[model samples]
Target chain A: MQTLNAMPWATNFWLAIAGLLLVTLVAGLWRIWRGPTATDRMLAAQLFGTTGVGILLALSQAMQQVALIDVALVLALLAVIAMVAFVKRMQGPSS
Target chain B: MNLAFDVLLGIALLLCAAGVFYSRDLFRAVVMFIAFGLLLALVWVRLDAPDLALAEAAIGAGLTGVLMIDAVAHLSAKNAHHQGAQFDQTGARPQLWSRILPVFSAVIIFILLLGAIWWRPDAPVSLPDLVAESLPESGVEHPITAVLLNFRSYDTLLEIAVLLVAVVVAMALKPDTSEPEAGNSKDPILHGLSARLVPPMLVVGVYILWAGSYMPGGAFQGGAILAAALVFLKLAGFGIERLADSLLRIGLALGFIVFLTVATSVMIGGRPFLTYPESVAGELIFFIEAMLTFSIGLILFSLFSQAPPPVAPTSSLQGEQDER
Candidate 1:
């Protein structure tokens, strides 16, 4: 494992990007928390899905680990399933 | 910089956890729980446990969120007429005294955990060392895969058995009456999106399954992805209702059946149960993992696909006897 003194900029740069994306994620969480409607909360959760992918991508790059990228891919692709389930639930059985 | 990142991540995790429990609406709480799962995945990454990170992101955040939202929807539908008491029994605010024990217990547990971590010797004997030593013979390059499938195969076998029992329990709970009719949509956009999405999902699931031999990916992650793909197809209005029940039943049991057969058959060599002969270890493990992927996928999909049993269609004794 490389120390903080060596290759400092690369790790810090990627981490900085991750930190900013996390801020966006927290903001999305705020919307989810304060939601007056289930749909609004679901949409904000979707934002969490996308922002999570971004954070994973940055961390993977920073760590120079390709496996981390696979986590991002799984999150990105399967993220839609939750949304689809939400939409179906919203439509109710009559739909 | 690293410390700063850790601090922010810790704060985000705490906030998400709080939001999940404190939110008044069950739906909002479920949504916040998904966010918490995602942030927990990030924490796993920071701690250098990529396997857990992947599992948490896929199963915890993705599929679990789907399941919870589905559950909440069913619940709200049942209680729709009673909406005036929105915070009914399940969501009722706890009494003040009710909160004290839980908080105190949580604090005690947290302190114990911290003490355990801090008390560890500088160079503790590690299980990884044993796993690594035996890994060459385990027919897998990944330590986790080796440990799971070979070194401690019993645990993995029992884990699969637990999944089997869960699916069984779910099946037993299913309503006796015939399933409700499908509500197929005629939306062309949904059709178009489903067509574009499913192929890639299948490919990715298979890739994850195959990569498990040498990497962080494995059957659980792959199976969850495959299950998600099925869920997506169903949600897009695919008429999978016609799929034969026998076929699904076979798929559900295939993993355990195959794994058990292979494990016992290997005992014919008089080595031990689940101990692969060195010559065919890789082939045996790959085949077992492949079967497990499909079975796991089918089980999880069925759990999500079936609705919670509706009030059993009011049936008279005569009608039940006639069906029997």
Candidate 2:
């Protein structure tokens, strides 16, 4: 139990992850803004989805709550489905 | 103990993100996003969220990657003539304020949240304490599993519903199209290699599902692996027709149906909704998870396929090439 109180490494570990995810988010935002096509923007959105999952995991660890992980799982599931729908739309009616 | 490992993981994640964001080819960008998902999953494990790591790898990277590639293919088919057209040509939109404002705001938000967490010294510690106290009776050893299935079973049930709704909505939007002709013949070498690879992938997927009870692996991880195997087969020109048929529908519905039936039965047996009988709670949870893996895999595969129903077999193998 004393080890839990003294775990500075754990805090630092999560902070590092958070910092990196923020960097990813910034890069992804650039793609969203500068993408040359709709598909490219969607690809950027997928990047955001992955980054969001990482952030959620880091938050769950920092807060010591498992519930946040569930949120991440649900978000990942939804993001994939949405990407699929958009892909179908872009394909148009089959010739 | 190893700070270097953490640094490596962080670097990998950043690189993958950069690839995803900067790639010129949309297809390559989607592939890089999948790799980024995998790297992020590793980061989650380093952060002590293995359950999340599993879900992230499976759903975040595996399924999402498939979906993105599917969209890319669809877009390519429609916009064949406009493949390289620039999406945003606002003429090098230099935004001194717009760019600075978002970064500044994000930084402020991050700082404020961190400060609040640090400042709240007496924030309630009830959840961890409760989880520790109740874990013994949970039948499962992992705190996350206990939380997901025992303590918060209701949330898990509804989450399955959400997955089902997504699949249904995707189906509604895209009616089934005629199967693409199986195009350009696959290299015989690649086909042979895939045949050798797929069986082992299936074995590993099952092992992950079974091992989840006592270990970090679980249904989501297993299902994602299974879906990946199927995707591999589709890419290699094997099993594309079967995947789109009754098999796909069954796989998608298995988790939702099993969970709902068991949950409703619990209420019928004079317990609250989703309350598993204490004696067999662990077994029930395992069963539910197994079903979920299958369902999740199917739902994800269908989402990627985007066809309302399975495509019929064609001799040319163009469908497989199209998938690639």
Candidate 3:
């Protein structure tokens, strides 16, 4: 907590936003917990993907590590591949 | 605030893990597992290791999820008519002793880990400092890349060989059912997405491989991206397996073959197995990484492609079109 107060305001702000993203990320887990349908659960996973990218970007600013942005880039691009796999496999059985 | 974020992230990770463990639905468990991967990547980032975070992000993004989902589909397909529960996973509740025994062992392991951390000894030499000193001769500016591709390249070679063997096993386990794959999907949106994204993924794959020279990227990451693109193509009905059979085997072995060639060829010069002449070390590492990128991509894609279909012929769904 003391470390939070000692930081510059911009870093603090980004860190706070990151915390908020984490909270929403946990919130998305709700849909996963009691998903009425598999597709609904899949949507929650997608939400986690997008928010995960945002969290990385926020942390990059707070930590001032440019490498994190590259992590964010990699996450952003590869995240969709999960959906492709899901759709292809899911469709195989039902349709 | 950073601490706060880390704490919250930790809690989220625990929650996802619990979801995966306790969920009755196999699909839900898999979904929670996917969410867990993203959170884990974040955890890796907070720990200041972008290299691990990159690898986790790549694998967590899709590969494991695809394999597990394929397995779940297989299970359900096999049990399509008989089982009362379609996607429900078995073994939800175990005998009390069975559960308690695992819990007890896990606690013991946790204690041992904490004790190990508490009594950790100071090293005779600082490894990172040693790496920094030798960074110049490493053939790459990036310390991690240097260590992976140059300093400890023997480990890298063996790792590629292991991947080759794994892919080989997957290829053999693949039901020699002859590849018409239950009809390639004709989804227009999927087609559009694949057409647009695959080229960029290929570009990013090569870029990551090239970026290994100076940054937190490498052949593994690049190869993963390449594999993902191939997977995208597979999903979008690219008919990759329909290409040459022998060529696919060659592609799968290329990385290890090239790596071994480099290692043994250097031995004839009477240098240690992987020691490159100072002049060509950088070029040699780059060339090996490029071959690795292509082979690793193919190897990973083979793992996904080789999974037996969820159901046998006459799928649970409609007409089983054997397009081959």
Task: Please give, as one word, the docking class of candidate 2.
Answer: incorrect
Worst 10 residues of 1 chain B by lDDT: B312-321
- What clash count goes with each model? 0, 11, 0
- The candidate scoring highest on lDDT is 3
Could you give candidate 1's per-residue lDDT for residues A1-95 as a string of tens digits? 22123265888899999999998998997888776566677889899999999999999877777788889998898888788777666545444
Steric clash pairs (candidate 3):
none
TM-score between model 2 and native: 0.67
* TM-score of each predicted structure versus truth: 0.91, 0.67, 0.92
Candidate 3 per-residue C-alpha lDDT over B1-91 given as tens digits, one digit per residue, 9 for 90 to 100: 7778888988999899878876666778899999999999999988988878888888788577777777766766666666454335464
Question: How much is the lDDT of residue B77 in candidate 3?
Answer: 66
All DockQ scores? 0.48, 0.06, 0.46
| C-alpha lDDT of residue B302 in model 3 | 90
How are the candidates ranked when ordered by DockQ, highest leading? Answer: 1, 3, 2
For candidate 3 chain B, the 10 contiguous residues with the lowest summed lDDT are: B315-324
Residue B296 miss distance in model 1 (angstroms):
0.5
> B155 in model 2: Cα distance from truth in Å?
1.0
Query: What global local distance difference test value does model 2 have?
Result: 0.64
Candidate 2 runs further than 4 Å off:
A1-95, B1-32, B83-98, B181-187, B241-247, B307-324
